[model samples]
Target: MLLRIDHVGIACENLEEKIAFYRAAFGVTVVSQEVNEEQGVKEAMLHVADGEGGGSYIQLLEPTGPDTPVGKFLAKRGEGLHHVAYGVTDVTKAMAAMGGAGVRLVDEHPRHGAMGTSIAFLHPKDVGGVLTELVESPAPRPEQTKLKNG
Candidate 1:
């Protein structure tokens, strides 16, 4: 089951530059950062709202190579909004449900994502021309539960 909007992916030519812009203009802080070799991207997650787990984020993505998907995207579309990711309880089930419903998928199986989450992507053509991602993060800690309620 999908829980909520997880994050918005923004393709950028440089991660540090984009990160600096967000920090200077919006005071957004990078909560986590990592490079996903499989995804061929260097990503930085900036948490918004209350800084609680499962909250929305801005995921800055820098292409690792010109041949990668994000790289090709940048070459064709330039740097801009790339995808919108939704938080799900079970990526496998969610992906299956979408497939059963005839929704086209970019990733047919859940794969490793930034921040140790399970993730899959739905093809843009099937999702109203927006590349959509399904993310399933580990259960939040007790403190996060309190933050969510508070």
Candidate 2:
């Protein structure tokens, strides 16, 4: 079982700068900032006014090292849409289904992603050259998020 689009990952050379740009331009509010040493990026999540949970997430990513994946992505493709993350009910089962159908995955299991979500990525080569992310939430529903945060 899968949910809806969790968030879209955007690769940027500077996380804060882009975060500011988004905040000013779109009126989006920064919800969280976290450093995921495992993913090799400093990420900031911007919450859109579309209503609850992760209504539409805008992520600003800056690489931790020159050779990190985001760094490589920047070197090869510059800053832009990095991946489209879709929310899944169960990361493991969703990944299994994708694999059985011959989907190429970037991770063997769900890995730690921004906002404490369990996430996995499908290779662009297998998904029509568009990198797809499968993310599973480890928290309450959107309605709950709205209630708690508001």
Candidate 3:
């Protein structure tokens, strides 16, 4: 089902400040950044390690509006750890298996996620009160392939 630990999400009031903090404190670099309108959040994926191994990321999330999920979370719990994401080869198949096993899900179907990934969320209550995300990463682009091969 799960391939590897993809990224750990952290909710923030200010994405730029958080990104700067991570860069200055941990020296991690931002690999990608995007706003997902459907999710109502702007997010950045920061590379957690360096080298050819291409380590995992720390995802910083900022809500787009007061009514958004991350915004409500900030109002209730303040900025902190949000969710843990695990990589999967196929999120659809993973969701089906998990559903068959009676794991409650927040998303019944996979949706578009950052960096063109397919993603789904599992209910926090069913997963020890921590939000869990299933992510199927997008294929490497031609530029990425060239970089890796060169």
Candidate 4:
């Protein structure tokens, strides 16, 4: 089951510049940042609000190379909204259900994503012309849970 709008992804040529822009423009700060080699991008997740057990993020993606997916997207569409990610209870189950319903999948199997989440992408054509990602975040560690609860 889909739980929430995890994040909205924006494609850009320069990650640092965009991050700075967001920080200056909206006063949001980066919560996490990493390079997912498999995804061929360097990405950062910026917090949208404060004081939360859970909250949505704005994911800024910068392609590592010209041949990467985000790179191609930039070449074609320029820097802008790329995809919307939905947090799911189980990405494997979600993929199965979407596939059973005849939705085209970009990933046949879940792959590692930023912050250790299991993720899979659904085809844009099958999802109302918007690229969709299903994300199953790793269970929070006990210390993290306590921090959130306290």
TM-scores of the candidates are: 0.90, 0.89, 0.90, 0.91
Q: What would the per-residue lDDT of candidate 1 be over residues 1-150, giving only the tens digit for each residue?
A: 667888999999999999999999999889889998998999999877544337678999999999999999999999999999998888989998999988888886789887778899998888889999999987773345778678
- Give me the candidate number with maximum lDDT: 4
Candidate 4: tens digits of C-alpha lDDT, residues 22-128: 99999997888999898899999987743233456899999999999999999999999999998888899999999999999999889998777899999999989
Against the correct fold, how does model 2 do in TM-score?
0.89
Q: Write the per-residue lDDT of candidate 2 for residues 88-118, one digit (tens) a residue.
A: 8789899999999999789987899776788
Report lDDT (Cα) of residue 117, candidate 2: 83
Of candidates 3 and 2, the better by lDDT: 3
The lDDT of each candidate is 0.87, 0.83, 0.86, 0.88
* Per-residue error (Å), model 3, residue 56: 1.3
- Alpha-carbon deviation at 33 in model 1, angstroms: 0.8
Candidate 3, residues 1-150, lDDT tens digits: the string is 667687899999999999999999999988889998999999999876433322368999999998999999999999999999988888999998888888888997899987888999999988889899998877863345666789
Best-first order by TM-score: 4, 3, 1, 2
Q: Scored by Cα lDDT, where does model 1 land? A: 0.87
